[model samples]
Target: MLMKANEPVGSGQTGLSDSEAASLYRLMTWLSPSFPVGAFSYSSGIEWAVEAGDIVDATSLRHWLASMLADGAGLCDGIFLAQTHRAASSGDDVLLAEVAELASAFATSRERHLETTAQGRAFIEIARAAWNSPPLDRLIAVCEVAIVYPVAVGLVSAAHATPLAPTVHAFLHAVVSNWISAGARLVPLGQTDSQRLLVELEPVVSATATRALKASLDDLGSATFRADLASMRHEAQYTRLFRS
Candidate 1:
């Protein structure tokens, strides 16, 4: 998995000189829900789905999550993360700003925008203060306007010189894990069942990451209208547990 520092952007290389253990640890730490991004408070619309009976059981939950990874915000965010990494790696602050702006405006609704921006703001603040890095700082300076969560993460990973494929995979995995956690609480799923569902989605996660790794921003699109509508509806959800 080792790749040279000079490899093409998004080449998915684990740099030859990069410490594999350190890279893994950094990815784990940043992606953990405990990272203070407040990821636990948002459901990414999963709460609305579960309440609407769209995701009632493990099977339904897996199906919904797969859809999200394949054709929804998951795909969009992966592109932002990958593109931002490449731009930040080359110190192209211009491109970084563009990606960040696009990600911010790409949100389909108020809840969706809040979900990305709030978490994004929190991520940059924490990463800058605690896990400071040159690349991360450059990203911040470049995107003076705003920094989306995926873009912030991409900047950090690229600064650390981590491989793109693994970074994106870990990012998406954390996302899915967070959503699963939400599902477990909202649906009151058993711990064993939650783990089982996660296991079942591993293949989907890998495939989504691979697809996003190879995808260009031109490929950005989503067919998950239900999810989008659910998020919009969540804004008015009479009794909701998640923020989005």
Candidate 2:
């Protein structure tokens, strides 16, 4: 069953079990900035937003990221992750392949496509080396095409038996955190402001994950036109610090 927005994940009436704890550990490790998916190298167009003066201060930064989480890539990626997790958990290879194809085709820009697929490939290769499993291997075989970021994460998490709620939550959190990191540098905000932004985004992340868990594939769409435009404009940005 899907977890509620406010429910504790990886815990029961007895609290966290060893297996649950292990799953949490794996999630943390895989989603960590240091996990080597090259997440730090991409700002998801936050750099362009900063350059365009769309995110000039903490308030603007918060609003921009909130929109992204609620209406843009953050929400879309969460839905893909949820769908992929469900398909993998059910051993539905057809559904899994379909999700993979849709996700790969979902990118709004060229750099966006590169950002997701490059990270997805790196994630699968690293996970296979460190956390190999039959399901993970099977996912690689069935998908065949270049996997997108969210699908790769969902597949790996399911292969290791991590629950869907926490996996989706962590994935969104990591994405938001990466964006904040970019803003911190581009906006030249202090560490406190960056941390404060992260704290403020917690509710958005939780709500996004919950919505994604309930979303159907037909619901997949992005309304953040400015954000998409930002991504496209970033490609032509002469002074760029991020890959996307």
Candidate 3:
């Protein structure tokens, strides 16, 4: 249960007590690692950091995760998540396209593109086919390349019937988990170390969740310089395991 820096957990008192809570629990369960968002395959920036020797072990992995949380995923993902929700609710193809383009252009590695975009595209389709959501389906049709991560997240949120904050929180949690998983595999960290990192990151995730509420596109920026460079470099790498 990683908590963003300042995010408050759901009150557990939405008055729906039994059935509603059960449904939400089910939704969260499905959206976890087993959800077909293709999340497990990508290291985001972790793959690149490991390749460049910047992240060689547990300590370095923690350092990289902290920097990424502060610089990129914390803000960029939140902003994109908001955009997806907006486009889906409004049924605006133009806006969705704009978001997709913006996100696609941000990718520096082929793996990054495939990792994020592939999921984004499939996500739109899943929402359309499974939920029969007209707005989301249409949004998918227009998004061919990497769908923006946030936008895909928003669509998933809508499909799950979870509100904005929970949806966003779930996303942040997934990122922390994914990065930890990547670190565990790439840096050969023990399961205990990975879990510890997740626990340590709870406050950061909680804090970021709250700060994310006030963030917009203008505030989206990344300070992980080497990570970004490694992603660019991975596109041409002769061999690699994880996507960017």
Best by TM-score: 2
Instruction: Report lDDT (CA) for all predictions.
Output: 0.87, 0.93, 0.71
Over all chains combined, what TM-score does candidate 2 have? 0.93
Compute each candidate's TM-score over C-alphas. 0.90, 0.93, 0.80
Looking at model 3, how many pairs of residues clash? 17
lDDT head-to-head 1 vs 3, winner: 1
RMSD for all candidates, in order, please: 6.5, 6.1, 6.9
lDDT, candidate 1, 1-244, per-residue tens:
7768886655254454348777888888999878999999999999999889999988899899999988898888999999989988887878888888888889988998899889888988887888777656756778866677898789888888887888999999998999899999988799999999889999988988888889988999999999999999999999988889
Worst 10 residues of 3 by lDDT: 130-139
Model 2: ten consecutive residues of lowest lDDT: 7-16
Poorest lDDT segment (10 consecutive residues) of candidate 1: 9-18
Off by over 4 Å in 1: 1-18
Model with the higher lDDT, candidate 1 or 2: 2
Model 3 per-residue lDDT tens digits across residues 128-237 = 56656454555567766656666677766654555677666777888789889977988788989998999888888777776676676677778877777776777666
Residue-level lDDT of model 2, residues 23-60, one tens digit each, is 99999999999899998899888899999989899999
Which of 2 and 3 is ahead in TM-score? Answer: 2
Give the lDDT ranking, best first. Answer: 2, 1, 3
Instruction: TM-score for candidate 3, please give it.
Output: 0.80
Per-prediction tally of clashes: 1, 0, 17
lDDT of 1: 0.87
